[model samples]
Target chain A: MQLDATDRQLIDLYQRDLPVCDRPFLDVSRQLGITEEEVIGRLQSLQDHQVVSRVGPVFEHSRAGASLLAAVAAPEQQLDLVAARINRAPGVNHNYAREHTYNLWFVMTAPDETVLEERLGELEQQLRLPMLRLPMVEGYHIDLGFEIDWEALP
Target chain B: MSTCTSPSDNGSTLDEQDRKLVLATQAGLPLVSDPWGALGQQLGMDHEDVLSRFQRMQETGAIRRVAAVPDHYKLGYRFNGMTVWDVRDDAIAEMGQRVGELPFVSHCYRRPRHLPYWNYNLFAMVHGTSRDEVEAKAGQIRKLLGATSAGDTILYSSAILKKTGLRLRKEKATS
Candidate 1:
């Protein structure tokens, strides 16, 4: 999108997760020889441009929460309505529609399993869909980061 | 840069602009020779300015990563299992912290103690090319954490529903 060298460098930092610290911007500034204010300002520009999505916690579930990777199968005619209902659940982090038997897919996080059950049961009754609770059968030990550089590949 | 704290060290006051920056970097850290350069051009700032704030936000714990995301499945690691450990109440946090630091142990977290149903207070994801390989790895973790009793189930991804970095600023939905 016609990025300048400075802007490009900032994005490069973004491309590679920026270091987390008390003065994260300052840390980034030191590497690029820019002031902290400039870092803040440029980030605003990126947001204004809608080039970047979010700047929040890539929360490590291991921190302090109960989470599960789960899904729901909704009847075809009621798919959209069911999806909207499932998304409304407080603990549901992500939701999507797929061609598989399990049409609605999502991730749920809460303080505990009882909470998850309570919420899911309510959702099941409300949406009238059978919930397929597929908790992580195995703890997956690998990073699933998508390579943005693939766009640049020939 | 001087940290602008709003009387609360928890950093709950981190505003919109700050949130946007963290969200963008998390969502799309473009892979290019000059990714920041590209970002700055779009954002209307110089390279140095953008870099510094990333450091500041991270320091505040408003965001987590500014690094690479790897594809675990394609890396020849076949077996991926979520091993739920029923460790003592006090030991869960310490065990989780140490386990999370492991390069091989990718995702770790603590949930409720659901007995007979899901008694795991501490959960760690283990991956390897073969079932035996991952099992062996999981055994190693059990030994290290000194878990009382642990059970693991293999979860194969039937399909990925939606996988994208979060975008707080709300871009137009892509079809």
Candidate 2:
């Protein structure tokens, strides 16, 4: 979707701290010199267009649950089947097909490590594929929120 | 001082109320005037109570941030590359931090290399409007890694097979 100047401004300014108060749209609108209804209308439109995924608190996975980056090399023919099975699991949140030997990759999280491992083990046995579980050893940087410069895009 | 809380250590810290709060807002906050009130109504608690509980969670580092998560693909950043590098273990921490500071690079982390089969230890995700743009950004990372980077590859996601917001199911089956 083509973004107008207001949309661009809304994106540029509201990356974080979205007015944690009653009538957040009113607050935001006042700052942007627009009406509260306009603010809400614009946000609703953005949401409808998939520009803004959500407006809420993003929990740190470490605090929310135990998670790991798991991958498996699926035969091209079976890739779809394997991915569909993995996606069926409740713990698997994000699954992707990437260009690599280990093509099917996904992130799984559970309430605890033992539970996570048990689920992964069950998945491995059911899929009959060696699931490589690579948990983050060290997190250097997270909270990757930033403004996108639309003006600079070619 | 605020320190990183490991998921393993903090998993049990989430009480029933916290879990309820999380599950409630997993989809997103209401776009209405009083979202906390909306959540409070759902939980049969006061709006102030909900807000205070969230504040406590934030202080404890449970909630990362209350913000808007934009869709990169919809925002014109069509190319999302997970650039992985096999860098010298000794030099990874410093180099990883530097690479993470790049504006376009998000979610940088050091993961264990599985050896012979998998050799990448550092991962930095770069987003751009096109494959060429992402490739250029990956090139910048390569230049930054310099001699410390033994080998690297960019795994561009072909398809997002599944993507969903976090949810704490009522059933304990998965957990």
Candidate 3:
């Protein structure tokens, strides 16, 4: 999808620290010197194009609940079936197929550590593969908010 | 006005009201002139209260930031790589922070090294418009790690099977 100047500017500017106010869009419009309607319209359009996933708060999972990244090496023949089963578990939120021996990777979050382990154990038994539970020990660089110089990068 | 002055004030333990607010905005804030006001109406709180509470949440590191999360793929970042490094345990803290500061690296964390099978202790996620671009970014990290990194691997994601923001559920509901 091609991005216009406003689209790029809005994305770069609003990626972090959106104003918290009654008329947040109005404040943004004032900064960009665009109308509030235009600001809202561009965001809506960006979302429609799937460029902007959403405008909201990114919650801290560990604080909100207990979460861990777990992976299993599904046999090539049963990759789809295994992945489907893993996804069915409510605790499993993000699941991905990465190129590696431990191919099926996912993140599971539960109310507490005990439940998290139980769910992971169940997945291991059902999938018939040893699940590698890699819990987060610490975060080194946590701020994902990037100052995307879109024009600079290809 | 309780502003979270320290990073330690992580909004982990939430009251009923806090949970309701988090649940309401999990999808995304509505695009309206008075989003907080609308939210307040839904939660039966004043707009000012909603704004103040949310600000505190951000200050506490419970909320990373209130912003537009751009889908990298839609923004032309087609390739994504999970770059793992087997850095010396003693040097990982310093090295991981350095690798994470690189603009292209999104998430950098120190996870348990499940060995004989998994040896990488430090994981960093890098995104690029092409595979070459991603590899080049990883190369920069390798250069940064220098000899401290025993080895490294870049796992390119082939598919995103499922992705949903983590939602907290109350009670001992076994899955």
Q: In candidate 2, residue B116 scores what lDDT?
A: 80
lDDT of 3 by residue, A71-147 (tens): 89998889999999999986888999999988999998888888888888887888889888899888987747555
Is 1 or 2 the stronger prediction by TM-score? 2
Q: Which scores greater on TM-score, model 1 or model 3? A: 3
Top lDDT prediction, candidate number? 3
In model 2, where do residues sit more than 4 Å from their true spots?
A21-23, A152-154, B1-12, B172-175
Candidate 2 yields a Cα-based lDDT of 0.82
Best by DockQ: 3
> DockQ of every model listed?
0.14, 0.64, 0.70
| Residue pairs in clash, model 2 | none
| Number of clashes recorded per candidate | 67, 0, 0
Maximum-TM-score candidate: 3
lDDT for predicted candidate 3 compared with the true structure: 0.84
